[model samples]
Target: MDTQQLEKETLEKIDQIVKNNPVVIFMKGTPQMPSCGFSARAAQALIDTGENFGFVNVLADPAVFEFLPKYQDWPTFPQIYIDGELVGGCDITLELAESGELKKMMAEANAKHAQQDA
Candidate 1:
């Protein structure tokens, strides 16, 4: 496939991943070893919520890293998605964490998915 086709496929893959997971973070690295400080903080906030979340290491995949911003017109790393929605980057995540809203959102998403599974 051509480069354009590859990028389109990558975008589609990103969409599918987001849809399939209740909470997902697309960051510079893994939550366990974030390469960016912003990503580290963002991932930690999610972790502090005591909720399970999926993470995609943008650094591990160039196509994904390049195409992610286009996914939602978001021009940043450590993009967090909740219930297939863009919840912004590190700063917003931190704010949510401080307000305890992150935990609630995560809980609700998990419950929603769990109900579907059941």
Candidate 2:
């Protein structure tokens, strides 16, 4: 496939990833024990907000590992999304946490997700 086709495919896969789970977390490891400091921080940010989230360890999925960067246009581990919208990476999450905005965002997202699930 050409670059454009590859990019499109990557985006479709990412969209499916988010749609498959209401509170999906694309991190370096499971929430219980994150493999990287950034992933740990992001995981904590979600927990700190009292949001129950699902995780995907890119370390475990070759296709996800290869395409995540193309999907997000960001070459980094521990990317986060809220209801399929790319919220940001670790630093942005941390900043939101420190500012007390993370909780509000997560709470709202959680409630929205809960409604959808009902």
Candidate 3:
């Protein structure tokens, strides 16, 4: 596929991901093995919430890596999406985690997913 086509496809994939998953992190790697420090901390915050979240390894997908910033107008890694909304990056996530808001948001999203599934 051409670069533009690939970017389109990757952007679609990103949209589907954030929309379908209540909580998702677009980071450098998986939660289990984050490639960047920012990614590691952000993933850890989600993990600490004791809620399951989806993730995309931007490093593994060059199209996504290149297109993601433009997708949200956020120039950073470890972008968190909650209920299909951009929730910012590492520091913001850390603040949310510290404030105990992250857990609540995750729980609400999980519950919403559960209700939809049921």
> Residue-wise lDDT of candidate 3 within 76-117, one digit each (tens)?
998999988999999999999999999999999989988998
The lDDT per prediction is: 0.96, 0.81, 0.94
Of models 1 and 3, which has the larger lDDT? Answer: 1
TM-score of each: 0.98, 0.83, 0.95
Top candidate when judged by TM-score against the true structure: 1
What residue pairs clash in candidate 1, if any at all?
Answer: none
Q: Pick by lDDT: which candidate is best?
A: 1
Error of 2 at 18 (Å): 1.3
- The regions of model 3 sitting more than 4 angstroms off are none
Ranking by lDDT: 1, 3, 2
User: Which 10 residues in a row give candidate 3 its minimum summed lDDT?
Assistant: 1-10
lDDT of 2 by residue, 8-107 (tens): 7767877887875656778888889799999998888888877777789988876687888877688887888776777788998899889998777777
Return the number of clashes found in candidate 2. Answer: 0
Order of candidate numbers by TM-score, starting with the best? 1, 3, 2
Better of 1 and 2 by lDDT: 1
